[model samples]
Target chain A: MSPLAAFGTALTALRVNALRSFLAMLGVIIGVAAVITTVSISQGAKRAIEEQISSLGANALMIRPNSSSRGGRRGGFGSGTPFSDADTIALRDLPYLAGASGTIGASGTLVVDGINWPSDVEGVDADYFDIRDIIIEDGRAFTQAETEARARVVLLGKTVERELFPYGGAIGSSVRINNIPFDVIGLIASSGQSSGGRDRDDIVYAPVSTVRSRLSGFRYPGVRDPVNAIWVEVRQGYDVETVTAQLTDFMTAQRNLRIGQEADFVVSNFADFIRARNESEKMFSVMLAAVAGVCLLVGGIGIMNIMLVSVTERTREIGLRLAVGARPRDIRNQFLVEAIVLCLAGGLFGLAFGAAGAYGVEKIGEFAVSIEPMVALIAVGASSLVGIIFGFYPAHRASQLNPIDALRYE
Target chain B: MGALIQARDLRRTYRMGGMDVHALSGVTLDIEAGAYVAVMGASGSGKSTFMNMLGALDQPSSGQLIINDIALHERSADELAAFRNQTIGFVFQQFNLLARTTALDNVGLPLLYSGMATKERHARAAHCLEMVGLGDRMDHHPSQLSGGQQQRVAIARALANNPRILLADEPTGALDSRTTQDVMAIFDQLNREGITLIIVTHEDEVGAHARRQIIFRDGHVLEDRR
Candidate 1:
């Protein structure tokens, strides 16, 4: 028999048992659908995070207490005071600096009227919102004059505003932070969640000057008291590495640290931080792909099992055909055609299912989701390959039957 | 009648439960062209084994088996398949028509296997159906036809290949009296047209219809008479 005849035979046999064939294809449908949805959603998440990280500005540099590995015992810059308050001033005085701010973190429950919400209070000098892409929703951030004068003012994040004063006015209300009453000066717009899904709006703000002088008592000796962490905004085109290097050298000289001894500060580049986040997302994608791969493998085995049972059921028919002059090759082609047709049909349906799955996810998220045509094509091709590979043994058995014994089989 | 088949010392041993069981034991036979022969045997006798060997569906354990002067045992398995298609036609007791296919396609199957183009395959298939008295029933499936009609379609397929030998394995076993007579008449006419035929059956009336009779007991031939 020619290949077409063999194929026609296979197609007819499959059609005869439509329900069983469809059930066999179900494994493929679920497998491909899962692969498409997982890849699209994960890549979507990765893209969102990368976009958020880039919003921090590539040239922005941060100098923390000390690298976490060294227990924050100042090593990369200036003395052993971790981040002294003078590091912020010294970094600001550099020629390439456009602006600078320092942050000290503290958490407290804000009480306005009868409302109480847990909030993160970031002690920042002026230019914090501008440098960090934080938008003020209601009015304005504390002015340089107010920050310098150590005013008792606050800005509510969008979620924080909802929690503390959802019904009415919060701008003029007073909320106590660490039992220290502060005036609500402004509100920050919803920055959505961070790349890590933390709520950006769950925060309150206070002046770094006050945090250093009174509210906070954590200190390392050596610079105008001490600071928690400092971030220097470099010129738009200046490299963070060059500025970090210059600041580190100047800080070392000022604090008088030995060549091999640990300094009190650690400098990190913005580009490196974003790269680390992206690497984490890539690792996550690999893990998802591995899981999806295992599912497809099981689907392949299911195809093989069904096809083998079909071959055994049709053994007599195969023998009769052979007795009537079908060559061994014709017999082989007949069974193979059944398997290939099965998988190819499964693959097409799987593509449709995967497409619909992706569309559903996109509609729910209301964001862009990518469906790679090449990935679907590869999936279809793999299914066909799987059909052939899994179907080979049974088809061979069908082809090798003795025509005489087969004819007499009852 | 011309000599169409010749055989000598044909032996077929079947392994039953990992032990050798001889199904055909040293039997020699000759069948002439256009002769209608009946092979009679009870269950487990060597008669059906002889039929299989003649149909080229099985190889003899030891023997010289020839069909139309061509040695079957010397031929490759594929060559035997081609030989069977070209030389021997079979009619099973079950009628053995592909159940879902139309009567026309069923008759044309041999030609389809012969690589006939679709138009020619359908044309020749129609012709074969008409010859089987199924001209008006060409498109009907086997399930839609009577047992007698289905057997006729099987005969049409057997004739389409224009084989030298027609082997019927209890062709009327499932038929009633009327359909059996109708089928027997068709076989009679085909034999008159000089097509060699062999029928394997236990029915004495069926055996009486053939010109020659060979009876079997166990794995050996007991009697041969003409």
Candidate 2:
């Protein structure tokens, strides 16, 4: 029979058993939906990470003191001898360095107009804003003169601004940090949430010199200029790995570490962290897709089972067609077409279901989930393939039936 | 007219539990065009096997069978299918109309394999249904039709490809006496139109309606008369 006519016949047969057909298609529907949903969510997470990494300054690097060993119990990172201000100056002088700044932070309470709020107090040099890509929303960043003169000027993060001056005039206001009064020179723009799930805008920024000499009133024993960490930004088109290697070598030599001694510092690149996160996320997506594939396989098996049952149930009908001069191939085509139609229909429904599922996840779970058009297309294609692969055996069995026996079947 | 069907020493054997069962043994016959032949036999007499060979639904085990000048043994299965589609029409005891389908579609089924366009297929199917006196009931499904009407729809389907022969296996077996007569009358009218008719029946009254009768016993023909 003509392919179109066979397809029509198949459709009629399926329509006659609408409930069974839908039951057979259910597996495929759920399988495709799961695949799309998982891929969308993973992709959304990857994108979010990428945005966070860029916000953290794509070319920025954090240099922390290595762990310190005392009585064989090693302290965590940044527990070794802190870097000196001379080290920051030396790193800033590197030809490939775009900017560098030193930082020290401690948790403290800020009070303005008797409204006290607990927040992190971070001390940084003038170049910290440029190195971290921090945009000032209200007032200007700390000037070089302010940093050199140890001015008690500070920058308020969005969260601190909102908490201290809810009515909006926080810039140029005097806020006391740990009972030390400082002028809020600028309001930092909001940067959403950090990858660690911490609020990014819940800290305060002040000059590192003032924080070390005035606020703390303490210094590392025998150390002239000590700082907790150094933030560095590399110039465009510069290799961060090469710059990191140079910085490591320079720091090791400057610290007088012997060849057998381990360096007392670590240079961590934000890009490397982003790459690692993406790799893990990709692995997670692949695992989810594999699970979805198993679902599709089960769905395909269900289709095959139903098709076999249908073939057996309609043996007499098949025999009648054969008696009326239908070729074996025609019979095969009819059943195969029925299977593909079921799967394709299921796939279309699954696309809608998956989109709804992704949207639901984003809304309810508050997670990222983006459904790309290509993913939907691939899902449909995969479902069609599943149909053909699983539908063939039953259709072949139907085609090979002896007409005499089939007609004689009760 | 030339012989429309010729069988030379046809035999059919079946293997059941590893023992050979001879269904058709050494049967030879020639049927001319426009002939109305009734095949009659008791149970296990091989009448059905002979009919299957004549309709190209089964191959003879050890003989030659030709229909419409084409040697059946020389054709491939697919070619035989095509030959059957173009050359023979079949009607069964149970009517065999596809349920839930309109009479028009049931009748058009054979034409679907004929590579006919949809419009032409429907037109020819409608014409055959009209010929079988089911023109007004073309839109009715099999469940909505009576026993006799369903039989007529099957006959229309058998006639859709305008084949050279109509093969009916107990065409009136499922009908009442009045309906049997009505179906037989349609067959008689079709025979008058110069289409060959082959009917298989055990009922003497049903066999009597044909112009020729062949009787089988012990897998061999016992009587042949016209």
Candidate 3:
């Protein structure tokens, strides 16, 4: 028989037992859906982290003080006083250094009229906004002169803006932070949420000099204007690791620390950290897809089982066909086509369900999810492969049945 | 002209629990084209085995079988299948129509296996159904039809390829006497239309309807009469 006619016969046979056919396809449906959904979610998360990393600043290194060993007792991370505003200014002239900024932050309550909201108040240098890629939605970033003069000007993050200025006009308004009034110079644009699920637009920014002199009283008598951390942006076309190694050497000599000594500062590349995270996420996604592939294998076996049952059930029909001059090849083709149709149909349904599932995760779960067209194609291809692989044995068995014995079968 | 079917020393053996069961032991026969013949025998007399061999559904262990000028015994299984498709039609006592399919589709089934296109296959099936007086019942499934109508649909299916020979094994065994007569009348009409007809049955009344009768005893032809 022609393949087209055999296909038609397969379709008719499946339609006769529609419920059983659907039941046979259910495993494939779930398998493909799981694959698509899990891959989409993981890919979305990886992309989100990539975006966050890029937004933070490419070729940027963050230097923070590590635990200080005092009297042979080690403190937690960022416990030393190794970094200050002077160190940040000294690093500005280093090779491949695009920009440098020092920042100090503390939790404080902001009051506008009678309303109040608790948020992190960060003090940054004039170059902090440019180095961090922070966009200004209103007004302008604090100028160099403003920072030198210790101007009490502030920038509210998007989330802080909503909380402080519900009726608009927050750019020129006066808001008191920890009972000290400061001029609202600008509003920072929304940066959305971080991959870690933290709200990125919920803090406030002010000049470092202003925060040190007024809010956080001077601490160290020897060093000038101690700061919490230093952010350094590398110039374009410069390798961050080379620049980082140079900066570490510079800091070590400036602090009079030797190689054997436990240095009080730690310098890290932000991109490396995030890329490591992204790689792990990708590996996790692959593992999940592998699990889904196992499910597909199970589904293929289910189809094989059903095809076997169908071959047994239709022994008389097969016998009749053989008696009417159908070649064994024709019978085999018919059943094989039936199995492929079942799997392909299931795969299509699975694609639809997976797309819907990804959408649901994005909407209801508030997670990033994106489906690739190639994933859909691969899913379909895999299901077809499954059909061909699992359907072969049963179809061969059906073709091998003796016509006389089959016809005489009860 | 030469005979349409010729068998020489046809033998079929089976191994049953370590013993040889000779289903067809050296039987020989010749049947001319357009002849209506009945192969009558008691059970285990090898009449059904002979019928299976004549229909090309089974191969003889040792013999030569030529049907419609093609040597069936030497044909491969696939070639035998094509031979059966092109040169023979079969009707069974159970009226083995595909259960959920319409009478027209059941009739068109053989044509489908012959790789005939849909439009032509349907047209030929409709013509065969008309010949069987079942043209109006084309859309009816087997369960929706009476026993006689089902058998008629089976006959229409057998005629779908317009085979030169028709083989009916106990065609009226499952029907009432009235329905049996109706079916026999159709067979007589088909035989009169110049198609070779072979019926294998134990009933004397059914055998009497054929133009020639061959009775088998102990895997051998005991009588052949015209």
Best by DockQ: 3
lDDT of 2: 0.89
Clashing pairs in 3: none
Candidate 1 lDDT, A218-275, residue by residue in tens = 5654456466677778877777678788878777787687876776567778767777
Query: Every model's DockQ, to 2 decimals?
Result: 0.42, 0.59, 0.71
- Assess every candidate by TM-score: 0.71, 0.84, 0.88
Tens digits of per-residue lDDT for model 3, A72-160: 99888888865788899898988688889998877689999988998988889878887888888889999889888999899999999
Off by over 4 Å in 2: A65-85, A95-98, A104-193, A196-228, A234-246, A252-266, A277-281
Cand 1, B chain, TM: 0.96
**Residue-wise C-alpha lDDT for candidate 2, range A31-86, written one tens digit per residue:** 99999899899988988888788788888999988998889999987888888788
lDDT of 3 at A281: 88
lDDT of 2 at A166: 95
TM-score of chain A of 1: 0.66
Task: Name the weakest run of 10 consecutive residues (lDDT summed) in model 1 chain B.
Answer: B109-118
Q: For model 2 chain A, where is the 10-residue window of minimal lDDT?
A: A214-223
Instruction: Output the better candidate (2/3) by DockQ.
Output: 3
